[model samples]
Target chain A: MTALIAFDWGTSSLRAARLDERGQVLEERSSTDGILQVPAGGFPAVFERITQGWPLHGATCLASGMVGSRQGWREAPYCPCPAGAAELADHVLWLDDVPGGARVGLVPGLSAREAGVPDVMRGEEVQVFGALQRLDTDHGLFVLPGTHSKWVRVAGGRITGFSTFMTGEVYAALRQHTILARTMAEGAQDNTAFLRGVQHALRAGSLLHGAFSARALSLFGELTEAAGGSYLSGLVIGEELRAQRLQNSALQPVLIGSPALTRRYALALSVLGVQARELGAEATWQGLWSLAQTLDTTA
Target chain B: MTALIAFDWGTSSLRAARLDERGQVLEERSSTDGILQVPAGGFPAVFERITQGWPLHGATCLASGMVGSRQGWREAPYCPCPAGAAELADHVLWLDDVPGGARVGLVPGLSAREAGVPDVMRGEEVQVFGALQRLDTDHGLFVLPGTHSKWVRVAGGRITGFSTFMTGEVYAALRQHTILARTMAEGAQDNTAFLRGVQHALRAGSLLHGAFSARALSLFGELTEAAGGSYLSGLVIGEELRAQRLQNSALQPVLIGSPALTRRYALALSVLGVQARELGAEATWQGLWSLAQTLDTTA
Candidate 1:
C-alpha cells in the first residue's frame, strides 16, 4: 500500500497526518512552527525536522493553508469557485525537493465573485467539498464559522460562491479588549439574550443600526455582559442572513464546522426562517485527502 | 482678577487650565496620570502634583470626565436631562478634605431614558452645553466627535438626551491591528475615497454589512490602501448618521470638537442630507468654565 502525507500549515500550528492508499490515517504529527513562527525560506527545513523518522521512501505529500499564501515557499494560484476536488488537484503545486525522492503538492484555495462581492476561501474549501460529497445533495449553502465566518454557496457538488463575516474576530476583540470585556462573566452562555439580540437585529431593519445597538443595549441593561458575545454573534449572523437573503433566496445553506460554531449558525438561520444542517469537522481532512488521491491518480 | 481652575480628567489624560474670572487663560498644566494611569486613591496626589504653585486657596475649581466615574475620587451622581448649568453645578461633589480650600466642584453628566433607550454623556455634556450657550440655541442636535462620539439633543437650554458611538476607538483598532491594517495607509485624508465609502455605507443600510464590504471593495479595486482609513471613517460615520436619523427626524446637527474631526463628521452627515456646523474646539473647556462660574456665583 502506498503511504501519503497531508499537512495543514496554519498561522500558528502545523498539523500533518500520514495516510495509507485508502486514506486511513497511519500516523499524525503536529508542531508549533506555523508559517508565522518560521523565518523566510525555513519551511523546507521545518518540514524535514518534523518528518525525520517517517517512512518517506516514495511518499506523496499534500499541503494547505498559509503554506500556499503569498509568503509561502511557492505562490499557489487560487482556483476560481465552483471548484471541486478535481479542480483543486489540477492546480496543486508539486515540489520535488524533499528527501527520499518524495514529491510534495500544495492544494490551491478557491475564490469567487457574486453581486460585486469578491471572496476567497483557503484550507476550508477542500473540507467543504468533502462534506458536500457526503451530503448526497446537488445544491446547498455551506457555513464555515471561525475567526472569519464564511457562508458558502454550493451547487452541483461544486462551490458556486461565498461571503465572509468577521464575527469571530469581532467577538474576540470586543470580549477581550473593549469596555464590554469587564461586563462579560466568564464561561457563560445565555441563549435567551442571544435570541433576543438576533430578533432585535432583524427588527432594526439595518445591520449598521443593529451593530451599534449592541453597545447601546448592553449599556442600557437590555443585555447582560456575559451574553454580550452571544448577542454580537446573533447580530452579525442575522445581518449576514439579511444580506445573503437579498443576494440569493433559493439556496439552502449547510453549516460545516465544530458543533458549537455550527450550532450558532444554525440558530441564526432558524431565526431567519431558513433550515440548516451541521456537517462533521472531519470533512475538511477528508476533502484534503480526497484531493490528494486525485493528484496521485492524475500524476 | 479672581482665578478659576478647570480640570478635564478623562480616562487617558489629565488637563488643567488656570483662567481668570472672565475665563482668560492664565497658565495650564497637563499630567500623564489620567484616571486609567493613576492607581486608586492616587487622584489627590496626582492632581496636587500637576497644579503645584497655582493659587488654589480661594479659586472656584471645576472638574469633569472620569473624575465623576465610580473609579474616580467620588461618584458624582448623574443629573437627568432638561438640566441646565445651575442643575449641573448643584449636583457637583465637593472634596470633603478641601472644604475651606478651593471651592471645588465636579460637573454632573446628563442621563435620560426614552422609549426604553437610556443615553448618558459626561465630560462632553459640559462641552456641548457650553457650545449651546455660545450658539444661544433653544433646540438642536450637538455632535461631539472623538474617541467616543456623542450626539446630544438639546431643547430649551437643557441637554435633553444623547447617544454615544465608539467610532474613533474602533477606527484606531481596525487600522492598527486587523487585516485591514495592511490596506490602510498611515496618516492623511483621502477625501474622494472617503466620500465614496460613506455613500456606499449609506446605501448598504447596515454597519456590519458595510464594514465587511470594505474588505470586498478593497479586493475589487473600489478602494485603495492610501484611502483605507478614509473609507473606514466614512463607513462608520455614515452608519452613525443612519442610526441617528432613525431616532430623530431633524436633519441639522451642530458639531462640537476640533476642526479636523468635525470636518469628517460634517462630510459624512452631508451624505445623509444633514447640514453640520462646527461649534469649535474651545467649547469643552468653555463649558467646564461655565460650570465653574455657576458654582462661584452660588458659593
Candidate 2:
C-alpha cells in the first residue's frame, strides 16, 4: 500500500506518484490537468479523478509547484528560504477537508531576495532537495533548467539563496513571435551550431546585441536555416551560464532537468572548465519523498 | 514644380514628401501602405495613389526602407558600408518600367560585417545620411531608436558600421506574451521607475536574469503594477546602452526618431553622462532629398 501520494504539479501538467513506506515509487500517473487547467473549485474533482481507485486510507498527499501559486487550489504562502526538508515539512499547508478526509499538504514554495531583487521557485525546490538526497549530501549548488531556470545554493542542508533566469521562455517567445522567426528553421539538434552560439554569447556581453546575431548571421549566409534554432538555443543557454560563474566554490554544480535540457546546460557549462552533474525528474520524486518522510516524523 | 517625390517607406506605414528644386518640403502626405501591407505587385498603384496629383513629370521619385527589401516592390541589394550620399546614389536600384513612366530609384540599404557577424539596415541609411547633411559633419555616432534600434558609426563622410538591437520589439513581446505581462500595467510615463530600472539593468549584467526581476520585484511589492512597464522599458534600453559603451569616443550620439521614443533614449543616455542631439522625420526627408540632389549632379 502507498504511504504517500506525491505530486509535482505545475502550470502545464500534473504528475502524481504513489510511494511506499520506504519512499520507493510503487506506481505513477500524470495528466494535462495542471493547476492552470483546474477550474475554480475544480481541483478536488480533478484530484479525485486522477487518484481514483488508489488506496487513500492512511495515505498522506503532498503537491509541489504552481499548484501552490496564487491561482492554485489554495494559496500556500511562499516559505522564506534558507530552507530544507525540515523547514518545508513545517510549512506544508494541509487541506484536511479534502472530500475523503485524505490528509493532503501543499508544499509551500521557496522565496528569497538577493541584491534587493526577490526570486521565487516552486517545483524546482523539490528537485533540488531530491538531488541532495540522491547524492547523500547537505551542501551543493543545483541548477534546474526549464521555462524559468533556478540556480540554487544549498549550504549546511538548506537553500541559502537562488536566482531565476527566463532563458527558455525568452527563447520560445523570440523564436515564435519576433522577426528572428523568419530566419530560423527548426531542425535536428546541431551541437556545433549550439556551441558556437554559446561561445558567441559568452563574448558578446549583451543579449540584446547577441540575439540579433541569430538574424544577422543568417542574413550573411553564415548560419544555415537548419541550424538557426540550435544556435539560438545555445545563445540563450549560454547567456544564462555566463551570468552564473562559479566563483571558486569547491562544490560542483548539479544540473537537474530532462536529458535534453540538462545535456545542453552541461555542454554550455563545460565551456567554462567546470564539470557539472545532471539529474532527471526522479529528483522531484525523491525530494517529495524526503519531505514526506519529515512530515511523518513531525506528525 | 516639384523637383522630387521622396518616400520614407517602412514595414507598417509610408510617408511621401514633394520636394522643390532646393530639396525643401513643398507638400507632404502619408499612408498605411507599408511594404507589408501592399498586395502582391501593388507598389506602383499604391505609389500612384499616394502621389496622385503631385507633379511627377520631371521629378525623380525615390524610396527608402523595406520598400527595397526582397518582399518589397523590388529588391535593392544592400550597399556595403562605408556608405554615404555618393555611395547610396551610385547603388540606387532604378525601376523605370513603372506603368506611368515616372522615373524611380529604390535607395539601397547598408550592410556591414563586424566581429564576423553581419548587420544590415534598410531605410535608416537614408536617415543617417540626412542627419549627417543636417549636422554638416560626417564623423558622428547616430542612434535611431525604434522597433529595431540602429546604432550607426560614421567616419570621414561615410557610415563605417552599425549595430541593431531589438529592444522595442522584445519589450512588447515580453509585456504582451510572457508571464511578466501579469505584473506590468501600461500606465503613464514613470521616469522614477524607468531610471530605477536602468540602474538595475546596468548592475544586473545579464538580461535573461534581469528581465525576471520585473516579475520578482512585483511579486514582492517592491515594483508596483503601474511602474512595471516603464521599469521594463528602462531595463531593455539600459541593456542596449550597456552594450554600446561610448569607449572615449568624443562624439555626441545623434538620436533620430519620433519624439516619444527619442525622448526615452535621451533620458537613458543621460544616465551615462552623455547628451544626445535629437532629430525627427525631417532627417529622412532631408536624406532622400540629399540623394536626389546627387542624382541631379551625376545625371
Candidate 3:
C-alpha cells in the first residue's frame, strides 16, 4: 500500500488532496497561500504547513500550477508536447531538501508549437490528462477557461497541442477599467446579452470590427450597460472563432471548466456551427487523479 | 471690450480662463472638482465655486469637454460633420438658472457619420478648430493623443470627421493591472525600444497579429521587460496605422498634444511611411478661443 498528496496551486489559492492507494482522495485541505500571495522563497515551508499531520511518513507529493513556475520552489522545466503521462511523470522534479524528509514531485508543464505559434500549459495538462481518462475516444479538443483560457487537442492520452486566450482577463479589465465599464449593469444575470453579442460578432465577421461596434451600439442605445459584458464576451469569443477559422476548422471542441464558463463556451461554439461537450468538474479532478495514478504505477 | 471665460471641464480637473476681446487670456483659475468627481446635480455649485469673481458679470462662458455631456448641467447636442464654428456657436446651451446670473454658452460637440461609423468630439473639437485657424492648408489629419486618442481629418476650417483609439487608457491598464505589468520595467527611459516596436508592428501588417508578437517576442528574448512599453506602444500605433490604411493614405497628419506624445506619434507615423507635422498645444486652447470669438461676432 502507498500514500500520496496532490496539489493544484494556482494564483489565488492552493488546494491539496490526500490520496489513498486506490487513487481515492482521503482528505482534502486548501490554503489561502497561493502563488501570488506566498513569499517567493517560502514555498517549502508553506508546503510543509499544508501537509502537516496528513500521515505522509512515506508518500510522494505531486504538485502543479504556479508552484512549478520560475518563482516557485524550483523551476521544473516544461515538457514540450505531444507529451503523455510517462513524459510528464519522467520530467517530475524531486526536491531533496524538505524539512520532514518528504519526497516532493512536481508535474511538468507542456509546451508545443502550433501553426508556428509556441504555446505553453501548466496545471491544465494534468486536468486535460484527467479528462482524457474519463473519455472513450482518443482524439478531441479540450478547453479550459479562466483568467487565461486554453484550448487543447488531445489524442491517445497525450496533449498533441493547445492555444491560450486572454479572454477572461481582458473581460475583467474591460468591465472594470475601460469605458465599457460604464455600460455594464450591476449584478450577474442570465447570458442573454452574451448570446446576442456572439451573434453580432458572427454577423460582423471580424473581431476588430465587432469590438468597436460594442461602443457604437452602446452610444446609439442599441445595447445597454447591463448587456455590455455579454457584448464583450461575444466579441472576444467571436474573435477566437475567427482566428481559429484562419487556422483550421475540422476538429470539434470539448469544454472543461466550471458550469457557467463551459456554458458560455458552448454558446460561442454553437454560434460558429460547432458542437461542444461539457466535461464535468469531477472529470477534471479525476483527470489530475489519473496522472497521480500514473505516477504511482511508475513508482 | 467683450469679456469671455472658457471652461475646460474634463474627468479629473477643471480649468477656466478669462479672456479679453482679442481672445488673450486675462486670468486663469483651476479646481480639482472635475466632471468625474462632481455629483450629477452639483455642477452649478461646482461651476460657481470655480468661476467666482472672474469678472463675468456679463461675460459669455464657453464650456467644453464632459461639462457639455449628458450628465453635465445641460446637454449640448452633438453636431454632425462637416461641423463649423457657426454651428457650435449657434447650438450652445445655457444654464437656465445660475446664482451668478452669468451668460453661459456651452459649446456643442462635433459628430460625424461616414462609412457606417459614427464618431463625436467635444473638448478636442475646440482645440482642432483653434489649430486649424493657424494652418494654411484646407485638408490634413489632426492627431490628438490622450486617454481616448482622436485622429481627426479636417478640411476648409470645418471638422470633417475623426476616429478614436483607446491608446493611453490601454497603456495605463496594461501597466497597472495585467501580467504584462509585472514584466514591464518601471519608467520609460529609451525611445529606442518603443520605436523598434512600431517598426515591428508596421512590418507584421495587421494589428492583431502584431499584438501577439509582443508576448512572443518577450518570451523569445527578442524583447526585454524594460522595452515592453515600447512594444506595447508599437502594437497600438501599428494597429492605428492598419486601421488608417483602410481609410485615406494621401493626406499627411498634423500631430497635436504634448511634445512627448507628438514625438511618439511622429516616430510611429514615419515607421508606417507617413510624414507628419507637429502641431502645438495652443491649437486646442486656441480652437476653443476661436469658437468663443465666433459666438461674440455672431451674437
Candidate 4:
C-alpha cells in the first residue's frame, strides 16, 4: 500500500513517487505534463492521469517546485534560508480534497538574499535537502544541474545559501536563437571538443568575451559544427564552475541529477582538479519523503 | 549629381548614400533588405530595388560589411590586421559590369587571432576607421556597440587589432528564450534600473552569476518587470565594458553608433569613471568615403 504520494512538479515535467512509512519508494511515475503544459488549476487532472493505475489514490500528496510558485497550482511562499525540513514543513501549503481525495502539501523552496543579489530555487531545494540526508553530512556543498544550475550550501541539515547560474538556458538560447545557431550541428556529441571547451573556459577570464569563441572556433575550422555544441556546453559549464568557485574549494561538491548531466558536471569538476560525487534522481524522491515525514510529525 | 553610391549593408538593414566628389552626402536611402534577408546572391536585385530612380544607379558602388561575408553577395575574404584603407582596398573583392552598369567593390573586414580566441568585425570597421579619422586620434581605443560589440585599437591610421564581445546577442537571447523572459517587460526603458544593473555588474565578479540578478531582484520585488530590461541591458553592457578592461584604462573610449546606443554606452563608461566621445552614423558613411577614396586612387 502507498503510505505517501510525493510529487516533484516543475516547469517542464512531473515526477511522483509512492513511498512507504519509512520513506522507501515503492513505485515511481513521471510525465511531461508539466504545470505550464496544463491549464491553471488543472494540475489535479494531470496528476490523476499520471497516477491512473496506482492504488494509492487517497494517500497524502507532498509536492515541491514551481507547482508551488505564484503561477503553479498554489503559491507556497519561499522559506528564507537557513531553512531546514522543519522550516519548510511549517510553510507547507496544504490543499484539501485534491483529486482522488489526496491532501496536498506544497513544499516551499528556499530563498537567499545577499548584497544586491537575491536568489531562489523551487524544485532543487528538495534535491539539496535529500542530498544532505542521503550523504548523512551535516555540511557540504551540493550542485543540482538543470536549466538553472544551482550551487547550494547545507549546514546543520539546513540550506544555508545558494546561487543560480543560467548555464543550461544560455546553452539552449545561443544554440537556438543566436548566431551560434548556424554553426552548431546537432548529432552525436564530441567529448574531446567538450573538454577543450572546458579548458578554454578555465583559461579565459570573462564569459562576455569567451562565448564568442564558440562561433570563432567553429568558423576557423578548429571545431567542426557537429562538435561545437559540446564545446559550447563545456565552455558555459566551465564558466559556471569558475563563477561559483566550485573548483578547488575545500569541501567536495555533491552533484545531484540524472546520470548524464551529473556525469558531465563531474567530468568538468574533475578537469578542474575538484572531485565531485554524483547522486541519482532518487535524491529528489528522498527529499520529498523527508518533507512528508516533517508534515506527518507536525500534523 | 551622383558621383558615388556607398552602401553600409549589415545583417538586418542596408543604408546606401550618394556623395559628391568631396564625399558630402547629397542624398541617403535605406532599406530593410540586409544581406541576410536577400536570397542567395540576390544582393544585386535588392540593390536594384533600393537604387530605383536614382541617377547614381550607374555610378561606382562601394559596399562594406555582411554584403561581403561568406553568405553575402560574394566572399570578400577578411584582411588580417594591421589593415588600413590601402591594405583593405588591395584585398577588396571587385565585381565588374554589374547590374545598372556599376562596378562593385566590397570592403573586407579585419580579423584577429590571439591565444585561440579569434575575432572578426564586418560593418563596424568602417565606423572604427571613421571614428579614428573624425576624432583625430592617432592611438586610442574605439568601442562599437551592437550584436557583436567591437573593441578596436587603431594607430597611425591603421587598424592594429580588435576583440568581439557577444554582449547584445546574449542579452537578446536570454530575454527572448530563457526563464528570464517571464520577468522582463518591454517599452519605456528605466535608466535608473539600467544604471543599477551597471553598478551590480561592476561590483559582481561574474557575468554568468550577474545576469541572473535581473530576474532575482524582480522576483524579490526590488525591480519591476518594466525596469528589469534596463537592468539586464546595463548588466550586459557593464559586463562588456569590464571584459574589455575600460574601468582603469588610460585611453578614452570612442563610442560609435546611432545617437541612442552611443548615448547609453557613453553613460555606462562615465559611470565607470571613464570618459567616451560619441560619433554619429556619419562615421560609417565617412568610413565608406575613406574606402571609396582608397578604391578611387587605385582605380
Candidate 5:
C-alpha cells in the first residue's frame, strides 16, 4: 500500500509520486501545470487533478520546491542551515487536510549565508538529503545544474552552505540577446567543442573576457557556428567550476539532476582531474521520501 | 573655411563635425542616422541630408566606426595593431568622389589578438588616436567605455594592442532579461551602491558567484531595489577591471567616452588608488583630423 504521496513541484512543472512505507516509488505522474502556469486560486484544483486515482487515505502528503514560495498555494517559511531532515520536518508548514484522512505538509526550503550574503534553495535540499541516503555518507558536496545551478556542501547530515551560479541563465541571455548569438548554431550539442570551451574557460581567469572568444573564434574561422552553442555552454559551466577553485580540492562532487546536465558537469569536472558521480530523478524521489519519513505517522 | 568633414558614425547615432585647419570644431551636426538605422542603399541619401549646407567642395570627408563595417556603406578592413594615424591614413577605403568634386575616406578599424584570440573595435580606434594626440604621449593606456568597452595600449604613437569587454551589453541583458531584474529599480544610479558592488567584486574571486549577491542581498533587505541597478553596474565594471589585473598596475589609463561613463570608470579606478584623466568628443574629432593630416592633399 502507498504510505506517502510526494511532490517535486517548481516554477515551470509539477511532478508527483506515490511511495510505499519504505520510500519506494509505486507510481508517478507529472504535468506542465507549474506554479507560474497556475491560474489564480487554481492550485487546489490542479493538485487534486494530478493526484487523482492515487490512494490518499492514511498516506501523508508532502510537497517541496517553489510550490512553497510566496506565490505558491501556501508559503512555507525557509529553515536556516545547517539543517537536515529533522529540522526540515520540524519546520514543515502543515496544510489543510484533504478529502481523505491524510495529513498534508509543505517542506520548508533552506537558507544559507556566506560572509553575510544570503543564499536560498527550495527543492534541491530534498535531493541533497536523498543523495546522502543513496551515498550512505554524512558528508558530501553536490551540484544541481539548471537555469540556476546550485553548489551545495553538507556535513554531519546537515547542509552547511551553498552558492548559486546563474550559468545556464546567463548562457541563454548571451545566446539569445547578445552579439554572441550570431556565432551559435542550433542542433545537438557537440561534446568536442563543449570540452574545448571547458578547457579554455578553465585556463582563462575572466568570464567577461573569455566569453568573447566564441565570437572572435568564429570571426577568425577557428571555431564553427555549429559548435558555438556547445562551446558557450562549456564556457559558462567551466566558469562556474573555475570560480569554485576546485582544481586543487580533493573532494569529489556528486552531480544531481537531469541526465544531460549531470553528464555535462561530469565532463567539465574531468578537466580538473576530478571524477563525479551522477544521480538522476531517483534522488528527487528519494529526497521527498526521506523528508516524508520525518513526519509523524501516529498523528 | 572647413579643412575637413568628420563623421563619428556608429551603431546607434551619427555625429558630423566640420573642423578648421587647426582641427578645431567649427560647426557640428548630429542625428539618429547611425549605420544600423540606414536603409539599404540609403546611406548616400542620409549622408547628403546630414552634410547639407556644409561645403564638401575641397574638404576631405572621413567617416569612422561601424560605417566602415560590412553592413556600412563601404567596408574598410581592420588595420592591425600597432596602428596609428599614419597606418589608418594609408589604409583608408576611399569612396567614389561625391558631388562638388570632394574626396571621401573611411577610417579602418583596428584589430588586436591576445593568446591567439582576436579582438576588434571600430569607432573606439578613432578615440584612442585622439586621446594620444591630446595627452601628447607617445605611449599610454586608454579605455573607451560603452556598449563594448575597449582597453587599449599604445607605444610610440601607435595602438600596440587592445581588449574588448561586453560589460555594458551584459549589464543591459542581466538587468532586463534575468531574474536579477526583479530587484532592480528604474531611475538614476546610486553611486554608493555601485561602489559597494565594486568592492564586493574585488573581494570575490568568481563573477558567476558574485552576480548572485545582487539577488541575495535584496532578498535579505541589505540592498534596496533602487540601488540594485547601480550595484549591478559596479559588478560588471568591476569584473572588467578585475580581469585586466589593473589593481596593482601603475598605469592610469586615460578615460575616453561620454562624461557619465568616464566618470564612473574614474570612480571605479579610484578604488585601486589609481587616478584617471577624462576625455570627451574632442578625442574623436582630433583622431579623425590627425588621420586626415596624413592624407594626400594634392590627390
Candidate 6:
C-alpha cells in the first residue's frame, strides 16, 4: 500500500522514508549528499535516483528541512507560528512534473515572532509535532539537539515559541578553528570529563570565562586533551540547559534525537537535577505521516 | 644612545621600538611575522632581522607579550597577581648570549587565580601598567581588544585580575565560516548597524539567540549584508560588555587598542550609558619602559 514518501533533508545530509497510512517507516535510505552536495543536475534528478523503484508512480512525495530552503529543490515559504500540522499542511509547496508528474509537497518551516526579532526552524517543527502525536500529550518542552539545538514550547498541539542555541556550531568552530584547539585531542570522548563539564555550568559566569578554562585545565595538568575537549562540550551544552531553566524553571525539556546525541543531553540534564525522557525515531516518521494525512484532508 | 630595545612580539605580529632613557621612541619597525609564523630559524634570527644595526652590542633588550609565551622565544612563567611592574620585573627571564652578549629580558605575564580556572594575558599587562603610569591613577578598568580581548582590574598600581573575551575571534569565525556568513555582505562595516547590534545586546537573551538574529533579520529583509556583519560584531562586543556589567555595574572600563576599535567600543559603551576613555600608544611604550626601569633598579 503506497501512501507517501517523506524526507528529512538538511544542510549536511539527506534522508528518505517510505511510509504507509499507519505512519510507519516502511524503508529508509540516506546519504551525506545533502542540499549542499547535490550536483548541477539539480535536486529532482538526485531524488529520482534515490527513490528509484519506491513507487513514485502517482506517489505523493513530501520533503522537509533545507530541501524546502531557497537553496534546495524549491523555495517552500516559511509558515509563521502559532502553527501545527494544520497550518503546516495549509502552507506546503508542491513540485510539478518531478520526473513522472509526481506531486512533491514541501512542509513549510516555522517561525517564532512573539518576542519581535524572528527565530525559525525548518525540519524541527515536524519533529516537534511528531513528539506531540507520539506522547499523546499537549504541553511539553521539546529539545532537538544538533548543530543548532532548539528549545521549543508547545501548547494545545501547536508551537507557542522556541529558541535556537548555537552550542554544536560553536563547539565545531572552537574545536577546529580557535586557539582552544591546541588543548583538545581529536576523536576522544570522555564521559567523566563530560559530566565535569555539565557540573561547571552551575557556576555563575559568561561563556568566555568558561571556554578559556579548557586550556587552563590542560595547562594545569588537571584535564587531558580528551577530557578537556569533553569538558568544553559540557560547558556549551550546560549553558544551553541553564538558559532554558532560567527562562522557565518548571518546564522539563523532553529530548528527541538519535540515541547517541540525546543521551549526552539527558546525562547533562540529570546532572542539573532535571529528568529528561528520550523519544524514539518513530516520532518524526509519525509526524510526517500526520502532516501527510492533514494534506490528504486539506487537499 | 640606545638606552633600551623593546619588542611587543605577539601571536600575529612583531613590533620593535628603540627607546632612550626618557622612554621616547627613537626608531620603530614591525612585520606580520609573529611568533606563530616564525620558522625553525627561530625567534633569535627573526629578532635579529627586525632589530638589525640597532646597537645590539651590549644593549638591554626586553620583550613582552606572546614572545615570552611557551611557543614564543622562550617560555617565561606567569607571575600570579596583586602585583605590578615591580612584581613583573622581579620574575623576568633573561638571555645571556646572543649575536652579542646583550642581556635580553622577557617580561612575565600575569595570571588570575581567584576564579578556580586560571586566566592569563601576556602583553596586555604591560599596557595596563603603562596606562596606570600614564594616567597617574591607581584604580580603573583596562580593556585591550584583539582576537581575545582582555578586561583587567587595576588598583593601587597592581593588576588585581582580568578576564578574556573571545569576541573578535567569534566574530571572525561567524563572519567567515558559519552559516551566518552567507547572509552577511563582505567588507561591510556600517556604524548604524553596529549600534543597532549594541542596542540589541541590552535585551535579555543568550549569545546563541543574539547571533541568529543577524540571519533572521536578513531573511526577513530587515538587515542588509553589510549592516548584518557590523551587527554580528556588535553582538560579540556587546555580550562582553554586558557580562562585565552583570558582574559589576559600577566600573567604567578604560579602552586601549587601535583608535578605530576603541572608538567603536566607546560608542557602544555610551549607548549603554557608560563612559569610557582611550589610552594612547605612549602608554604601552611607557609601560614597557616602566617595567624595564624596575628591572634596572632591581638589577
Q: Candidate 5's interface RMSD, please?
A: 1.2
Score chain B of each candidate by TM-score: 0.91, 0.97, 0.91, 0.95, 0.96, 0.95
lDDT by residue for model 1 (A2-34), tens: 467878887788988888877777777889988
Query: Which pairs of residues clash in candidate 2, taking residues 3 or more apart in a chain or in different chains?
Result: none
Give per-candidate clash totals.
Answer: 6, 0, 6, 0, 0, 1
Summarize candidate 5's per-residue lDDT along B207-282 as a digit string, tens digits: 7777889988887789998889999999998888887788767888899988999999999989978888899867
> Which candidate wins on lDDT?
2
Off by more than 4 A, model 4: A1-3, A45-60, A99-102, A294-299, B1-4, B45-60, B99-101, B294-299
True contacts kept of each: 0.26, 0.88, 0.11, 0.83, 0.75, 0.50
What TM-score does prediction 2 earn? 0.94
Q: Candidate 6: which docking quality band?
A: medium
B1-299, model 4: which lDDT tens digit per residue?
77778899988999988888888998889889887799976877888888887775557888988989888998888888898888888988888747877878888888888775677888788887777667776677888888888888888888899888888898899889887888987858778988988888876667777888877787778888888789899998988877666665666888888789999998888887888888887898888888888777986
DockQ of the candidate models in sequence: 0.25, 0.74, 0.17, 0.67, 0.73, 0.60
For candidate 2, give the lDDT.
0.88
Give the docking tier of candidate 4. medium
Model 6, residue B68: C-alpha shift (Å): 1.0
Q: Residue by residue across A1-299, what tens digits does model 2's lDDT show?
A: 78889998999999999998899999999999988788999998988988998887657899999998889989998899889888998899998778666888999999997667778888888888899899999998899898998999999989999988899999988898888899988799999999999988887777787888998788668999899999999999988888776534455799998999898888888888778899987898899999988887887
Q: Tens digit of lDDT per residue, candidate 2, span B7-87?
A: 989999999999887888889899999888999989889988998887766468999999998889999998998887889
For B43-158, candidate 1 gives per-residue lDDT tens digits of 77887787788887877778898888776777787888778887887888877565337766777777766555455667988887678768877678888887777778778877
lDDT of 6 by residue, A1-299 (tens): 76888888888888898998676778999888789898655888888878888888788888889888878887888898788788999899977768966789988898887447788888999988888888888788899998998889888888888888888888888787887888888646788988877766556355655677676677668788767778888888887776665432555778999898899998888876777889865576778888888888887
Least accurate stretch of 10 residues (summed lDDT) in model 6 chain B? B242-251
- lDDT per residue (tens digit) for residues B1-299 in model 6: 78989988888898899998798899999999899999754877887789888888889888888888788888899999888878998889998756656778998888887446677888899888888888889889899987888889888889888887777887787777778988987755688888878767656345766777887778888988767878888888887777776333466778999998998898888877787889765566778889888887887
Where is model 4 chain A poorest over a 10-residue stretch in terms of lDDT? A242-251
Q: Per-residue lDDT tens digits of candidate 3, residues B35-102? A: 87998789888888888766657667878887887767678888878877887778888776765778
Best by TM-score: 5
Q: Where is model 2 more than 4 Å wrong at Cα?
A: A246-251, A296-299, B246-251, B296-299
